[model samples]
Target: MMDQLLLALQGLRRSRVWLSIFRREQLPQTEADWLAMNRRNFFVHILPAKIHKGSTRLSYNWIWMGVISTWLFVILTITGLFLMFYFVPSVERAYDSIKEIMNSVTLGRFMRNMHRWAANLMVFAVFLHMMRVFWTGSYQKPREFNWVIGVLLFVVTVLFAFSGYIVPWDQLGYYAAKIASNIADGVPYIGPQVKQILLGGTDLQQPSLLRWYVIHVFFLPLVIVLLIGIHFWRIRKDDYSKPVEYERGRRD
Candidate 1:
């Protein structure tokens, strides 16, 4: 029985059906073949087959803020999803649910801590990434629109953190959200209406909780993911700005 099961698993691993679903149709047989396969495959195709050595230099990129930001986002997503298993998005039960997670659920406190810290780190990471881009003149000419998209992404990242802040229904989150909503209300023209829409009325309560939960978990994730895809797609198309030496060498 064990031998039959092992054989079955091995057969499935090499089967065309399994390969089609999990991997590219073409199997790479050599170093050259692997590089070509990346361009041909749907998933890996978006990534550049080759990157400039100067562009990837640690001195030029300095800890790769953009990549770190992306990793932090991934961490936040995983930790947040795990946290949701124990979280209730209602005002009455929300704080208590958090308490239960910290006290009762195995590894729940760790996940919550990871989510909190990742969200905080992402904000700084993204800001630093933008600064690095600006410092490197990566936003010049052809990359201007990409910079705009990055700014929008930064905004969306902040909104995601803010929206998630109230999920615990703690006094800190509650008052902070109220202050933010009031600040929104002070904006020109649609300020009052925007505040009304956000709070769902005059104050932050059940409606606000539901709205924030939906925005935090669903809408903002969709927007950020779409924008991130576009950002990377453009990188593949334009390629990131090269080091100053490369630019000078090309010009010469």
Candidate 2:
């Protein structure tokens, strides 16, 4: 019975359906095999088959701020989704909804706090990552476009925080939105139109709150996600930027 069961399991493993999903049934045993596996594997295709030794060093990347930022975004997305279930976007109930989440919902306070902190930390991490890239001269040569994208991502990250800031519709949120609109109003020719479009009217009201809520929960998230996908693809295509020493040597 045991022999028959073992044979059955082996047969299953060798089946076409299993082969289609697993790609390689056996673990790679050699360096070449590992390289090929990395090239062929869909899940890891975004990563290069090999990496620079310097890229792995702490001083070069400053504790992998990019990775930390990405993980923080993941945390924010998860906790934000959970909080969304209990969050009412209506102006009348928005603040009370937050109170309810904090006081009544299970794990609600934790999720909200997690979402808030992750959002804050992601902004900080992305800033540090960008600074590291700049100071290391990673923005030179073929990487100039990626640097532009990084700058755009930084702007969007700030917008993400700003949009989310106004969702609760409390005094702080109200003033924040007011201040943002006031800033928009200072942008010269397009300022008034921009403020009008953003607030959906002349002042901060239900329409403004609703607009920001949609942007915070939907539009900005979608935009940032697409940008991140392109950013990672660009990194893979361009390869990780060389360490400062290697870069300088190549130029010299």
Candidate 3:
């Protein structure tokens, strides 16, 4: 049965119609051919065709914090989307909506818990990922710019978490947003202006809630998506980010 299934799968893979519709284009049969094809293939080009064997070792790279961050992001996005269906971003309704979701919507509380925890986990993962990179000396040489990009991504991640914190509009979220805005007001030159722009007024009210909702749900997510694409592209360009020692004298 297994041999018959394998033969059938092989025939399906070679079917001209299946190839044209699903595969779209053939994968290169050789390393050189793949390198050439990668230049024009967006999905295929985002990751290297091969990584050094040492790069796959836990002892060499420690924990896979970067991979963990990516998975956490996926979980957060999924749970966030589900929560969005029941969320109301207005100051008057935001807390009530959360209550309703928790008390009424099936598995809503679980989803909300997952979203919140996953978001927090993503922040921790990104921080550890940065630390891992620093410890491994992966931030030097051709990866300096990539390290800069990673820093920016960390900042964005923090801001994303902060923005999302106010969505529920409860006392905790309300006070948190107030503190954050006040910190913005502490900026050197544009302090007051920054606070005003963030709150959309002299205080946190309806406009502030709306603005945070827009930023958390739309603007920040879009920016992060673009940055992540560049991050992956650079990772591919840097030879799948094998440790610097792999190219030195460590190969055994």
TM-score of each: 0.86, 0.92, 0.86
Q: Which structure among the candidates has the greatest TM-score? A: 2
- Provide the lowest-lDDT 10-residue window in model 1: 243-252
Per-residue alpha-carbon lDDT of model 1 for 156-206, expressed as tens digits?
999888877776779987987798889999999999999998898988889
lDDT of 2 by residue, 1-252 (tens): 999999998898899998988876677899899888877776778888888888888988899898898889899889988988999988899999999999999999899999999999999999999999999999887888889888999999999998888999999899999999999999989999999988999988899999999999899989889889888888987888879887776556
- Pick the lDDT winner: 2
Clash count per candidate? 0, 0, 0
Show the colliding residue pairs in model 2: none
> 26-137 in candidate 3: lDDT tens per residue?
5678878777776766766766767778788886566788888888888988998999999998888999999999999999999999998998999999998898888877
Q: Which stretches of candidate 1 lie over 4 Å from their true place?
A: 1-35, 248-252
Question: Global lDDT of each model?
Answer: 0.86, 0.90, 0.85
Q: Model 3 reaches what TM-score against the true structure? A: 0.86
